[model samples]
Target: MAHHIWRRSLAVAAGTAALTVGAATAASAHHCYKVDWNPNAYANHMSGNTAWMPLSSMGAMIISAPAPDGAGLPQCASYASVAVDHWMAETGATSEPLIHSRATVGSGAAYQGKTVKPFAYLQDSDYAILEEGLGMAIDQCMADQGA
Candidate 1:
């Protein structure tokens, strides 16, 4: 009777340990695929804008942004050019991603009755760099307009 009770207790303990390990594994797996967004970054940018969300843990969206205006496609292209230049200057050639700009005419919240030339950074390290680069580009544009 004593031997049987001991065996039963051992079996229960083993089952509890297995369950605990499984639960821990599942939690870690879930954490890896979670999508996090930075509200501060979202608030600072304009209407037609996308970038790596600030303060994210792992994984980032393919960097992309819609052009500013529909009628002025060249203006949008120029803006992307300037932004890329600023980004390159800040991050250098080795760290900077391949910048691509393309114009697309569409009607939506971000692009309503305008041609938006989207800018994409192929390989960027973090949101901070992208945000700074974007801010610099926009500032340059503003300065040009002011001049």
Candidate 2:
């Protein structure tokens, strides 16, 4: 399951017994210039924010890097947030069952459409690592199918 793989990856990155993975540490000091980035395979992956949806739909989820905390302000490079509000609505988890979850982003607000969001903050130096991680997972999944 994607959950198991993601959790294991998080655990490996965090170096913690708790499996609470977020983002890698930034190596630089000054804020790096903004970059237009996203995972190429989002259309085929899933996020806990979208647990409401079947694994089949996980890859269809598209999301942006974490924006700064304030409006129009993007969060630091190490912070990318995801939104599951759309996925939740699509899955009929409209009540407290999904609202109380931190895995889900937005309140069915902000972004418009269907998707699962898992907000992750990445180090400024490695803003795109998440995509690579996803790619690796996808490759592994594909390899599994081939086997």
Candidate 3:
């Protein structure tokens, strides 16, 4: 009985290890594919008129679009988070993920004395910040283009 129990335990451990390795392999195999978007849909500058903006991440290049009126920063963050959640949903890039999202935005740190609001949601109770640099880059792009 003891030997039988040991064999069963070993089998279970082996099974768990195999499942973990398979999941990791699948995830690593995931790659970004081609996508299409209207170039005009993205904002060229920051304005009272909200618009979609792009953010870069490790998994993909994402976008942050304006939140509905009264949705505030949380909504903007959601826009970014969702884009990263699915990656290709908001990007036009055809290559593997590139760019490290980074920037200093409104009431945040200093980036050439420009601080724009972050467009992507980087932090939440359920997950750590995705690519903060992407958030910053989005804000800076808005500011630079607006200027």
Best by lDDT: 1
Candidate 1 or 3, higher lDDT? 1
Candidate topping TM-score: 1
Residue-by-residue lDDT tens digits, candidate 2, 73-123:
111111121122322334343321211122434425424653334322123
Q: What C-alpha lDDT, on a 0 to 100 scale, does residue 52 get in candidate 1? A: 28
Candidate 2 C-alpha error for residue 48, in Å:
8.0
Candidate number with the higher lDDT (1 or 2): 1
**Could you give candidate 1's per-residue lDDT for residues 27-62 as a string of tens digits?**
232211112224554444322354322211111111
Task: Point out the worst 10-residue segment of candidate 1 by lDDT.
Answer: 54-63
The lDDT of model 3 is: 0.30
| Ten-residue stretch with the least lDDT total in model 2 | 69-78
lDDT of 3 by residue, 1-147 (tens): 676555444433332233233223322222211123333423221121332223322212122221221112222233343324433333333422221223222323323555433222222311222333234333433343332
Clashing pairs in 1: 67-117, 70-114, 70-115
Give one clash count per candidate, in the order shown: 3, 20, 7
